[model samples]
Target: MLWLDVTHRPGQAPWVRLMGRYLLPPCKQRWHTCAAFLPQGGLLVCGDRRGSLLLFPCSSSPGWAVESAGIADGGTSPVSEDTGSGSEPSCLSHKGALPLEAPLSVLFGLHGKMGVTSVTCHEGYIYSTGRDGSFHQLRLQGQQLEVLRKHRPCKGLQWIEELRFTPDGDLLVLGFHADNFVVWSSRTGENLHCIPCGGGHRSWSYCSNASAEAFAFVKCGDVMLYHREAEPCEQRVLLESLHGREIACVRRLGAVEVPGHTTLNIFVTGSEDTTACVLALSERSRAAMPLTRLSDHISSVRALALASPVGVFGLLEAARKLVLVAESFHHQRCVLKVEAFLHTWAGGERHLLCSAATDGSIAFWDITSPITDATDALHRAEGEIQPLGGCSCQRLCSASRGRPRWWLLCSLPPSTTFFHVPDLAELDCWEVAEAGGELRYYCVLCGRGLEMLHGIAPPESPLLGAPQ
Candidate 1:
């Protein structure tokens, strides 16, 4: 698929073009976690079963190979060689070797044979909860790996399925079978709060935009929005009976588009019923609209992310256009994830439609050529436009400034891949064992560009008598 550069004014072609056919070696086991674009350029961290972790660089050079396999059982005693002298029975034993590899080195022998279920990073510290019911904090000091904090058998949380940080840096953990979530102070590891929601065998939870004053969580068929109040806490069901099926993923739309009215917060939910819906929330009531019906996969959806603004803007203007990407499923199946990017254009003349999809392969289509005026076109077209290309994994995310220099994160089955549009070739890929993990790209706190980047220049030196 061709990656078009949409940051520039429409009609300007992409500056870089790379084929989207390169495939990495398959892993011995499935990936359990994936992180993209570390502080270092073009580097990704992936963790998996067998207690292994791998780091892949952006380039194809030999220097890119790095591995951290799991640890082995030390040979502190001999067992099989023992022979019974008389009546005492002799026992036979087998020696277990340690799995030494790079990514595993980062975990520092904290994770056990049950393997890791969730991983997240905050500040410079990496926090992960293992299947062994342990929570660990791993920090990097120069080249040494240190365990800052380790909690064996987290008090109430078991089988951590997801991890998120509140706006205040409070860690929010979702327990798989326990039916509860815990919020902790990151600095002190003090448990601040624990909230319970009904649980399901395969349910997952995620927080909305971190900066929001409140957050929301969805599991099974329920979506609850929580607001922090001084007097008492309040939570209401914004939308329930979602998709008439099990909810797999929830994502908050970045910002809304309203000409003159106050914009409201919106969220999109994907479910196991082969349907996805968009929900708009306001002080008065919640309205949900069905967005798409994905029919190819029989399993529950594992990942969902928003596209870059280039795709967003095109869809906003036309309300209908076609673009597609490659996508894969948790069952190691590949299918196309397609949707229309639609928006009401100038003068409300037409509903502009731009489409995007992932079919395990990349395909590009430019629908900018206007076909008809807005009013007449809406009634005439029966459906939205469809974009090209397919994605293996559903973990989609886009980052951009004012312009359309957005990057798309595609979480494949065994690898986490990245592609920048409108030049839609694979920019980088990291071998990760799991899907539905989270990765973020942001400057370190107190690092360079933290202040200057967000700083606004002082108002021009005003003369003693500046113009009123």
Candidate 2:
């Protein structure tokens, strides 16, 4: 139960053979399954075909296998001596492998008859959906599985397809397989409300704001936004038709509070037509307004991310006020450009900006160092995106999942890779997608087309907190 790198090609014998008792499917079980990793890195919860859930933990690191491999000859599996002729029997020599140190240990198992479809891990508990249309919450008490609560103790709803946990609260949104979606309170197990998401789940992609109070889901190129409210009218805040083209991606760029001034939510939508539209959501009126449309790349923009705020610009304005203290401060310079930052986001600890360009190169910027004077500010005003560090990641598109761990995903292999939030280093990565063919070594991943909204830092305003 460790993640080992089998350095062998596909359709080939595994390099390290663990020969002891391993956990396999119980005899003959179905295969339609779903899984989610627990917050703690080692454990993984998986739904099985026999309508059971299993918790599996990694017993060792593949790196450890790599180290022990030397003691085991690593991968020099002895093949039959060919005898240099076609009439020779080949003898197998077992010299390169040892059994896995620890067999797959089943920490918790919920055995049943129906198949489990979806599973998600929350603050402390585990939620799952089964083919029986039932939802269950399980907690690992010691070595046993404890069923804390089960929604629809009798009959369940239509097969639930999608599950989303609100970012800021204890709300779980479940999308049904055939009809509308429901919002449930994971805290109290109450079905808070229901939203009509077109037809069960077809082509709609959903996104929500930080609080999860506001949500937008697109269906067949048309976008609809819904927010939680006491009345019906306020529930449907936006409904826009895209006329024809499908939406490639959409994101909540960033949220900024102007300190006793205004708080705005930024959103960017990239479509298939090689264009992106930036929109703003105002908290005062709970309304979404279109801001600007960006069209520069001839190809479809694939990803988006948000970077740190341009707080350095404030220094230029601040320096302007010190003119009276200088005797010969006579002239000033001004520059403007018509370039467009169509796909943008600020993340990676609010200091790194990422964007996926059409030329197959992903760019990253260091936004942590704010400009102190008008000189640096003028340098950036020339419409050129001067990335702090630039590398070529041949990806079509990508998007930033936004703050905390400013995760950026692209279409290339190692599909999910991230920069260290604080240092922007390419150290940690997650390869979550199902493997299709021979997995090969990959280049560093880069790309994003979404806007990164303001981070969770307190707004330090020279304009608001200054001496009047």
Candidate 3:
């Protein structure tokens, strides 16, 4: 394990520097499963796949002396690094020196053959769960751990994987028995609910209050939600697992009329499972049917762009890298240092693109010409606008006025900015029609939600100052 020092300066991002690292013993198979830090003592408790708990004292900061250290129980010694001369035992190593230390204590075979899945601390005691269908409450004594109590297997739970406490001070045990996922309450020592989720190898979450409880899990690649309250319990399928996991992004591509059927809205969705799909939505029944899936990407698809007649652009997530693909012309171009692609629109006779960067700057680009085999169609942007650090550009929409005006949503302060399109002159007031064709002047901003007020007039003075 490694530790680092974090430094944060005013008006600057935080910086993390490496402090020190601990070295594990050689010739030992230590497949760690869970770990937690002690609240009172400067110690770290770790559990391994071998059902063993190891405790290491982190009392000393960096720059400690180096020496050969053996396990307190005389079982194994800390691993030794091979210097030019010979091998020497080392427990912890500083940034500039080779200082090593061994674990303070090691308790072997606490859970028999099954591995420890989780370890957590509450109050002054530590609780651990194992795949052996049981959990144990432990306390620290000097450098060793003493078992305070052992809990029996929850009802209908044969293989315990996790243990959590509810807000109402009840212990919650989650595991799998037979072919179902089970949740048991320690306060009543009874099974709270059982869901036929195939097994416990998938992702799951549970939350409960005094009045209601909700459990969500994945089965057969589909997300399922189970809510239990005073009334009859409800269970429903949230999203199908066709993409295998949660979808990342979705955009409406407009509507199409099916033969003999109602009109359907066409949408493109990108998923974390590394695929993009085209789906048809029936507004009448509120159902989405997948039409086709694109499996060309090997990474999670985070963003998508559609250029009709040209092609679809699927963005595979990567740090600070942007690539635009024009499928119809079979051309791929790299955009240097562009952070996020916000919105794209057609302006008179030119195609325009807006993008924001991590450094709080926005840019407008023109890509009107068609892509060719020899050159990319991207042209120099009209200008760049550098804003305050906390400014987050949400959505941009054009006004229907004769003189082009644009509305920009700055979500940080929950306000709107209006300006002329090309020249970007700050405007005091402007009118824009919503998607449903209602004219609205000012946007009533709530926390993460927007309500367009039609009769409300814009402020007499500009909402934002001129960009410098």
Number of the top lDDT candidate = 3
Candidate 1, 73-149: lDDT as tens digits: 33223222233334322111111121112232344235665556656667767666665555666665554446675
lDDT of each residue in 1-468, candidate 3, tens digit only: 555455544543334444445554332555777888898768888778777777777754544434332323342433334433234333233344634457787777677667777889998998888777778889999888888766654333557878888777777888888888888766444577788878877888877776788878887778999888855559665755445555565556666868988877666777665667777767467566777666446567777654323242322222111234432322132222333233445643544555444334455554444222112322221233221212223234433332323334422122334322232211122345656876555322111111122242233335444322
Model 1 TM: 0.30
Per-residue CA lDDT of model 2 for 198-224, tens digit only, reads 645454445555445654677778887
Question: What is the alpha-carbon lDDT for the whole of candidate 3?
Answer: 0.56
lDDT of 2 at 251: 57
TM-score of each: 0.30, 0.31, 0.39
- Candidate 1 Cα misplacement greater than 4 A, ranges: 1-28, 49-51, 59-110, 113-115, 141-148, 161-177, 186-193, 200-468
Over 4 Å off in model 3, which ranges?
3-14, 23-29, 59-98, 167-169, 230-468
- Per-model C-alpha RMSD: 28.1, 26.1, 24.0
